[model samples]
Target chain A: EAEVAQSPRYKITEKSQAVAFWCDPISGHATLYWYRQILGQGPELLVQFQDESVVDDSQLPKDRFSAERLKGVDSTLKIQPAELGDSAMYLCASRPTGGLGYTFGSGTRLTVV
Target chain B: GQQVMQIPQYQHVQEGEDFTTYCNSSTTLSNIQWYKQRPGGHPVFLIQLVKSGEVKKQKRLTFQFGEAKKNSSLHITATQTTDVGTYFCAGPISGNQFYFGTGTSLTVIP
Candidate 1:
């Protein structure tokens, strides 16, 4: 089965450092999403993209967090000057069409010390 | 912002026992999706419910959408050790964003 791919299964960084996570959704999928999951909590949407265009990013921290799907395929999410509160599991999900269940990658666990 | 609520934040059951989780939304949803995430693992799509009053089933799981289009349920019959995980209900809300319920954390005793 075609699955979403994520790099850096785990990351530990000092506060105020920069970190980046990567994701590659299944082929042909046009919609991609980034989510943050705290321990014992449901995942929260951080951003959404339709093809290479951002659809929603209200939940994203614009000053420090940025994401890009330059070619409408694999995507990269970066955080500059990370904070301790940003420590969480960052999940990347995607769907072939606009309305359907999403396929999530294993995720990148970030721990900002 | 949209709010999705799920009842019984946590559930504990013995092996072979049945379990169910409920999801409610403050706003009407265009569609609802169910997902399961194992401990320290990513969420995998279980099913999707569209149209008012829709019901779908897998091998040992069943899902239902309320007639009013504001609620949904997931039932597991005779769970096993592998059934232990968090089940989340996601809904497509206004502005093409998804709102996920709090989730029901299931602990299946071995």
Candidate 2:
């Protein structure tokens, strides 16, 4: 089975620093999502992309967070001047057009000090 | 904004017992999906319920969607240690946006 790939399984950085995470969705998937999950809580959507265009980003904190899927295949999420509260598991998921379910990557665990 | 809530934020059950979790959405849903996440692991898709009053079973696990299409439930029979994890229900609010429930964490004790 094809799997979504994520890099840097774990990361720890100081507050006010910049951090970035990458995700490569399965081939042929047109829908990609980036989610942030606090401890003991459900995942929260931060951004969604259709092909190379952003479809929804209302929940994203544009002041400090940014995400891009330039070619519609892989994506990158960045948080500049990270805050302590930003520590969480960042998950990336992808689904085919009109597909019923999503395949999630292992996720990048972020820890801000 | 849409929200999905799950009851019994946490559940502890003895091995071999049955367990169930309920998910309720603020608005009618086009479809509902169930996912399981083990400790330190990412969410894994388990099933999807579409039609109203639809029910599906996968081995010892059963899933049901309400007639109103606003709620759903997941039941596990003869729970085992491997069943320990958090269960989440998700529904799409629009063509591109999906929301996940608060999640129900389960701990099966042997």
Candidate 3:
């Protein structure tokens, strides 16, 4: 089975530092998503991409977070001047067009000190 | 914004005991999906229920979609230690944007 790939399984950064996470969706998947999971809460959508265009980012904190998928294949999410409250598990998921379910990556756990 | 809520935030049962989790959506859903996440792991898709009043089972696990298409339930028969995990239910808000439930954490005592 093909799996979504994510990098930096864990990250620790200073409050004012910048951090970035990478994700590679499974081949042929056209829908990719970035979600944030707090300690005991479910994953919340941060952004959704269809091919190379963003479909929805209503919940994303535009002031400090930005994501891009230049080639419509791999994506990167960057947070500038990370804050302590930004610590959480960042999960990347992808699925083929009109697919019923998603394949999630292991996720990047971020911690800001 | 959409909300999906699960009941019994935490559950503790013996190895041989049964367990169940309920998921409710704020709005009518076209489809519902179930997922499980082990401690320190990402959520893994378990099953998807599409039609209204549908029931599907996976050996020891049973899933049911309500007739209203706004509620779902997952039942485990004779849960084992390996069943210890957090279960989440998700539904699409629009197109491919899915909203996940609060989740239910299960702890099976060996």
Candidate 4:
């Protein structure tokens, strides 16, 4: 089974430090999503990308968070001056064209101290 | 912003016992999806319901979408240890933007 790939299974950073997470969706998937999941909570949508264009980022904290899918393939999400409240699991999911289900990556766990 | 809520945030069941989780959305949904995430793992899609009052069944799990498209439920029959996980219901409001329910964590003791 093809799976979405995510880097840095776990990350620990000091407050105000910069951190980044990377995700590579399954080949041929055009729709990609980034979600933030707090402990004992559901995954919250942070950003959505249709190909290389951002479709929705209403929930993303634009002040310090930025994401890019330069080639419309792999994506990178960066946070500058991370805060303690930013500690959570960052999940990446992708859906192939005409597919009904989303394939999710293992996720990047961030622990901001 | 959309809100999806799930009932019984935690469920404890013994092996061979049944369990069910309910999901409700503040806004009508075009479709609802269910996913399960084991402890320390990523979510794995289980099923998707698109039609109103639709029902789908897997080997040991049953899923239903409410007649109003604002609620859904997942039922497990005779759960095993492997069924221990957090189940989340995600509803798509627009395009690919989905709002997930609070989730229900199930712990099955064998």
Report chain B TM per candidate. Answer: 0.96, 0.96, 0.97, 0.96
What is the CAPRI rating of model 2's predicted complex? high
RMSD of each: 1.2, 1.0, 1.0, 1.0
The sequence of per-residue lDDT tens digits that candidate 1 reaches over residues B1-110 is 43998989999999999999999999788789999999888898899999899999998999999999999999999999999999999997757778788999999998
lDDT of 3: 0.96
For model 4, what is the error of residue B40's alpha carbon versus the real structure, in angstroms, after optimal superposition?
A: 0.6
All candidates: DockQ: 0.90, 0.91, 0.91, 0.92
Residue B50's lDDT in candidate 4: 96
Q: Tens-digit lDDT track for model 4 on A13-85? A: 9999999999999999999999999999999999999999999998899999999999999999999989999
Give one digit per residue, the lDDT tens place, for model 3 in B61-105. 999999999999999999999999999999986765789999999
Candidate 2 TM-score, true structure as reference: 0.98
Q: In terms of docking quality, how is candidate 4 classified? A: high
- Tell me the deviation in Å of residue B44 in model 3: 0.2
Better of 1 and 2 by lDDT: 2
Candidates 1 and 3 compared by lDDT, better number:
3
| Stretches > 4 Å off in candidate 1 | none
C-alpha positional error of residue A67 in candidate 1 after TM-score superposition, expressed in Å: 0.8
* Residue A29's lDDT in candidate 1: 96
Supply the DockQ value of model 4: 0.92
Error of 4 at A4 (Å): 0.6
